[model samples]
Target: MSSISLPLGGDVRKTRQNSLTLLINRFGVFFMILVLSGVGLIVSPGFFSSTNLLNILNAVSYLGIVAAGIAFVIFCGQYGDMSAPMTMAISGVISVEFMRYGLVPAFLAAMATGLVIGAVNGYIVGKFRANAIIWTLAMNFILEGLVRWSYKGTQIYPDMATEKTYQTGFFLPLLAKLDRHIMDIDLVSRAQAFNGLATTYPLGVPLVLYVMFAVMIIGYIVMSKTTFGNQLRVVGSSYEVGRMSGINATGTVMKAFMMSSLFASIAGIFMTSLNRVGAFYIGQGYDFQAVTAIILGGMSLSGGRGSMIGVFGGVFTLGLISNILTLVGIGTFTQKMITGFLFIVVVAVNARSLRKLGRDYA
Candidate 1:
């Protein structure tokens, strides 16, 4: 009698699905990037020229920094930071306004602003268990209102003079050094070397682009190579499990929030320098957009998975889409709509892929 060989049909199907998903996960974004680049070249002449490519990188550079920080928060299973836009705007304002003291001082002050905000956010959310989404939204609104009120609904320019009569008397002299021409717009303009942060192109590469790359690389190292990164992944997987494992779950969460805020502040500072002005409205739409980028990069909103490289791809994809759309004469508002639609589609595809791998929605 001869024996017939048999195969487990279900196992074979699952093996095939697992391989498919793995392949998609590894190369899908780059493949899409290539496709989008092709579309750009077809639709927009010279879209991939060195100058224009640099332009795309520069345009998304600050936002990429913001997304890098937000990625940590998402990886830790917390919601996105809504206060990021304001963090960037306010920090930039601080940098520009404090430039009279010196570049180092102004930069430090801007950093301090971010540090304080991030600390407060971390403590409140991580310790008190405040809802991250609502709390961050509140912070965002509070910052927006405070900035608007303080500036009297006007933009703060490096060269713009402060009102001396009413409110300026108190703080201006307190912060300004003993110089008669401290209020002189020309002197202030000359002093604001901070603009170099955004303007300087090293080796013909935009400084902000370098900053983005640096931040992303650091984040990658932290997440992939550090013990803290491992702890963060454990915490993201399950806070209770993390606690059981003797991890500082609260501190880990706090650090994640702080990281996000700090990154946003950096982006904010550069953006302000680029515009040569600081306004509450600066960096608007960054929070949602950053979240979108994180999701697009293959990070689960439920946390415990993602890579900085993937996050950058997500950021680059968005920039590519925007460039291609612009080349095809798509209006800004319509581009937003199209991007929104794309976001939904990508999210759905990611979810489907995960399901095929026999994973839950987390």
Candidate 2:
């Protein structure tokens, strides 16, 4: 007996289509990055220099962490975390304030604050089916007000706290005698842990740079290899279908929100440490920046499709643009306008592409 075989034309056509899509997804952002890099090299004097390049990488590291967290929520087909900035601010302030007691205590306090906030957000948005954007944004404002009221719009500077004459108001003045270098930006800067180093050696990179890459690697693994990732994808693809398939859609979404907020907390801790000061506005504007980075990476706001590598490329591209603008003598206001314009263009193009795909499917 002879076995039946499917038609070759359909299979061949599908193979070609898949190949094209894969090519487009993998290379689209990278191509833009390359083009921007070339333009930088041609237009800017020191665009290709080691110093400038390292600067770009260092800057990208910070945004990369935040974007990674945001990507987690997007993976689960959730709205962006509008509370990320507040989460960062609160965590940083708590960490900085508690630093006077002990490193262990302060770090715990910070992480605990973050986890608690994450849980709240996760429960509200995921379990209760609250509006992610509106609820999170409301939470952001509440936290902001609370922080300002507690801190009195002041900053916590570790370096200044050490000096006897440099006394400042503390929520807990009793435990304000410990001298830990947790917020010592100078030491960290010299060590090049989280910040990109000015010096260059292929092997001699910063610890923070490694940390960013580690986050990306972990994100990629979680999204691509794990069972939770599969559930998230399924839920994101279709909530009703995922439920019918017996996937715990609510729990998965909650986990995604919790994880995203957790990452935001981490970003806050790093920001506070780097700045050597904990202010109410430490992570301001990062939420939108992360969103922009996600969109630039070609992830759908509707969720269920994206890659970590593309996110990295998106971050690097943004960093490159900022660096290039600064080098070319653009003012802060002008840079903001330019960034806004670029964001609008990218979003429009992405929306158009998505619509076209929808029509094709229809």
Candidate 3:
């Protein structure tokens, strides 16, 4: 057979085509966002209002933070941490109970608690090769039982002790400084600073929303721009191959679980602050919600293929959908049905696309 000569610019054309395809794949969530937002705006005049928009952001802040953590586990090629919901609940309770000591101490104790749990999970799944799903699910149940039995269904709150700390002017002022840093405020007056930190800022953006934004940015950088990210990608793509190539597959996975728990602990603190109470049921359904958001963000369940920004988009989209449903007078049960349907569709599409990209999942 005679070999055919290629066109002179064929290589350049192929590169450009590949670049275009990559861009589309990376930002495909935006299309869904636009469509859903358009429908919201058309169906409800209040959908795009500044107040309503801020509400959506505030409502989704904790969920988004947890989703970022979940994305980390997915990136590391693990199924998920079913213990996330109970972890958040317990962390919040621990933080609230320890607040009698001080904010810093409480925060540290809560985070240390999360780290211990994460280490246990990492040791089991990463080191000992335990089944992720079964182990994490069992962990979830154990934590839940512990919380209920320990607290006896009593809710913990920042009581007179927290008030005393707040009145001392030390904690509140420090919190004010933190707000100034997060919001990039220029004013130095204590009143303004305290006001900025304690409640809604600027137009209506909650301080919690700022926390979500910060977490997302940090997560994106860690998962996309760092050497650790590269290792995670390789490990996630093929654990055996990564091991053969001298990558510390087990260590990377352990780090991923730790990071996930750390982030979840932070989310728990925020949730406690927002709700002003800590209970065993505080994070009852968030584990499932975070998983849904992660998958909806276009990350492969098989791992090694997704962007943090996509997960952000997924959280935003879910928030928008929930808000729209509430605005349009939909029932909570009906909304759940819609959300479940959409999740199935997104996962199916993601699986198909991954297959097209030559990724095989057993």
Candidate 4:
């Protein structure tokens, strides 16, 4: 029998082609970002302004944090976390109420609240094998009811700036010190430069953005580099296969849920701090937004493959698009319409990619 062989040049060309394919598959989102950013800059002179760019980053910081955390659950092949927004709202409200006790206590309380909710989600999803969508939706409703009943439709605006200043003698300076410590030297310098350019921007942007980025890096490392992340991936890809491999699929899923909730809680605290207020319906639809960002990040709705970098890109993309639309005088309805349309486009692209890959593998 004779076997056909390619020439040396052919082999080199094939390798280059494969490399290009891999690059595109891995960095397609960045390409989209470059295109979008270019368009934004060309169309709106304000788009490239340092102040506007900083505003966009700051605006999207909370969403990025929330989406990063929720990516865990989505990565595990779960439907969605309905209770995330409510958890955020509840935690925010609790933090406001506890502010008088001092920032540390209030922050702890908010995080604890998130942990409790996450535990409940994990127990129900993991131990009881509950339907994630239905259970989380019910949990969200329960949280909503609790908030409504507790607040009686009232909005609590905690003067966090005043409280922090009074407690620390200078909120901005203290926060700046904290920022310098948390963020790397390079980022702190850039943030300081940006702040100098735009006096109206909040200091929280640097601190919160750095924290979110750090969390994403940690999450990525955990998911891609650790045994726990491997187990979760296995469970997401195929529960039966994971079980056959001696992995406790249930336990893994539960842990994912808990982690997701915990992050959601932390995001809630930051959001509340930014607004310095909490209302009964404060976090309405935030869960959907997080899910949208996750999906747009190129994560499989079917689960098992994603990246924190992609999620961050999605968050920034969504935030930038919204800001651009607002700047262009688009109404809320139009913005929602455009967002939904963009989401469909992204998901459709992802689905097509998955189908092609599956066919190739087969």
Candidate 5:
């Protein structure tokens, strides 16, 4: 009877306040996308075309795949993976070389190569406790050197002629008879529509875009709907806490790196498919691009928070900006400068938000 009613405490209030704060924090990236879209549409007429829109999607497709995969690693609190581009290039080269055997064989071989590279990244970063940035950078240099030495600084072009001939032998008749129109509209009748529309499959766009989309979706599901994803989040939040929770922190980080490398390799394959060529320098600086897309998607650089959808949005935004600049006939240097500036701005905003979150949590 002497036990009095418990009072509502400050800690409870603080917890409620933080919950609201976190909800708002998560929306910053999405809001930024809306704001950018509005500004872009208002400023540029060319930004809204079906063709231009498809082009943006096509252009962003491979990068989006890479960014989606790497977003997990960043979310896992790894500093960065510099070996992404290298992994891509190596996989591309392997895929091109294996094409002489057959498409299926070639693709499988390329994926295998990617897996190996991913394993290597994971081993170094996880087992050795190496600095992610430095380790990945060194691995990148090694890969580049190997590629350069093997190719003697030359580019390897996929045998499109052979590919066409093979297609003609097997797929030509089927493709020729396929319906092109969608809903009686000629807009989706084009080859590009196969990238998303359910009608006729475009020879190149279908394979590349569909693969990229599939990868993105899978990555999204893995990061958001799985036990592994939860483990990654915990590890990213704090290695010490994660370890105390009986999660293998190093293993989680390694898995993230592996996934990142695997995605990069897939991106490389798409690039080769699109370009019909593999260059030693292919995917140059794409690691940074992936990082930029991840950050712009609203992922915290400090780690443990991001989504595949956000990465896709960020990739779309970047592609839109780049395409608009090109359509306007902006010079290469000017476009790079503008893009770089925008990247800096977006990243700065995200960084500020992350800092605020840390302070609030503290």
Candidate 6:
């Protein structure tokens, strides 16, 4: 009899608490960010300084851009493109080499090549339902070997300071004056633009930071507001269900892959410009780095859940850790170890949560 009367609204109160817990769990990246920021401040007073923050943003912007692209594939339920790093590597190398022709041509060539690679990956994966990770890994190795062979196992140093001297007039006299004028203005101006890709600071902010944020904003809009985004979400959730609902699942996934490729290539250009060189190793570890960022950003490995804001949080979190570690004198090797450790922990937790929900951890 005493137990027969329950408190009024107790179930409602429990529901409210559950909702709060879910929100906390879902947005835990931001909370971790706050915690990490506090830790950074405690460890290094300069962690939040304008100069240091700008450096952090600059350092992570390339990865952030790459991560934003790879997130699309993750969103589409593709594990990831293992070839992303190589996409960046080859694209950067090509851009630098193409500069001999002209900067505009170089930029176009880099972007075009990246899209071609992405289109191939998307088509093969979508048409055959092949294992995306394995296929892309193979592609990565193949591209690596080609790059090494092409460059004779050396890094391609960009000629940022000089353009290739042209030999005109003798071979083609009719076009001499126009060619001379065209080549003269064309090479230097576009090269300046190319260098500015990474160097220009809008209001003392690295141009790459602006680019990274812009990509994130566009990505968010595409994923949240558009019809294709809706289809992508449905397809990501369940390909069969999406197909049944008249969605072009394969095409949708293909676009995601292409977007990822384009993003990687973009990162490649900036990174190459920053380093002033391109080589097989230019983007060596970006593949897993991007996935880690997206995953830690509150996205599930199995796909169909994430946000650009969450991805940005994840990217900043990694950079913050690096800056803090550097302030505390941790070297790059140790930093890698710490990062790899964190990645393992996050994936494990994600898998556990998925298991609890009786979901596939694909």
Per-candidate total of colliding backbone pairs: 1, 1, 0, 0, 0, 0
Per-residue lDDT of candidate 1, residues 49-99 (tens digit): 898898888889988999999899888877678889999988888877677
Candidate with maximal TM-score: 1
lDDT of 4 by residue, 64-169 (tens): 7788878888888786788888888988777665554456766787788888888789778876768888999999989888876665565665642332332222
**Local distance difference test values of all predictions, in order:** 0.82, 0.74, 0.76, 0.72, 0.71, 0.81
TM-score to true structure, per model:
0.89, 0.82, 0.82, 0.78, 0.79, 0.85
Candidate 5, residue 311: lDDT: 81
Candidate 1 residue pairs in backbone clash: 88-268
Order of candidate numbers by TM-score, starting with the best: 1, 6, 3, 2, 5, 4
**Model 6 ranges off by over 4 Å:** 1-17, 100-102, 160-193
lDDT of 5 by residue, 205-295 (tens): 5455787789889998999899999999888877778989999887888789878888888888766665556666778878888888777
Candidate 4 TM-score, C-alpha based? 0.78
TM-score of 6: 0.85
TM-score computed on alpha carbons, candidate 5: 0.79
Query: CA RMSD for every model?
Result: 3.9, 6.1, 8.5, 9.9, 9.7, 6.1
Clashing pairs in 3: none
Candidate 2 runs further than 4 Å off: 1-22, 159-204, 359-362
Best by lDDT: 1
Ten-residue stretch with the least lDDT total in model 3? 185-194
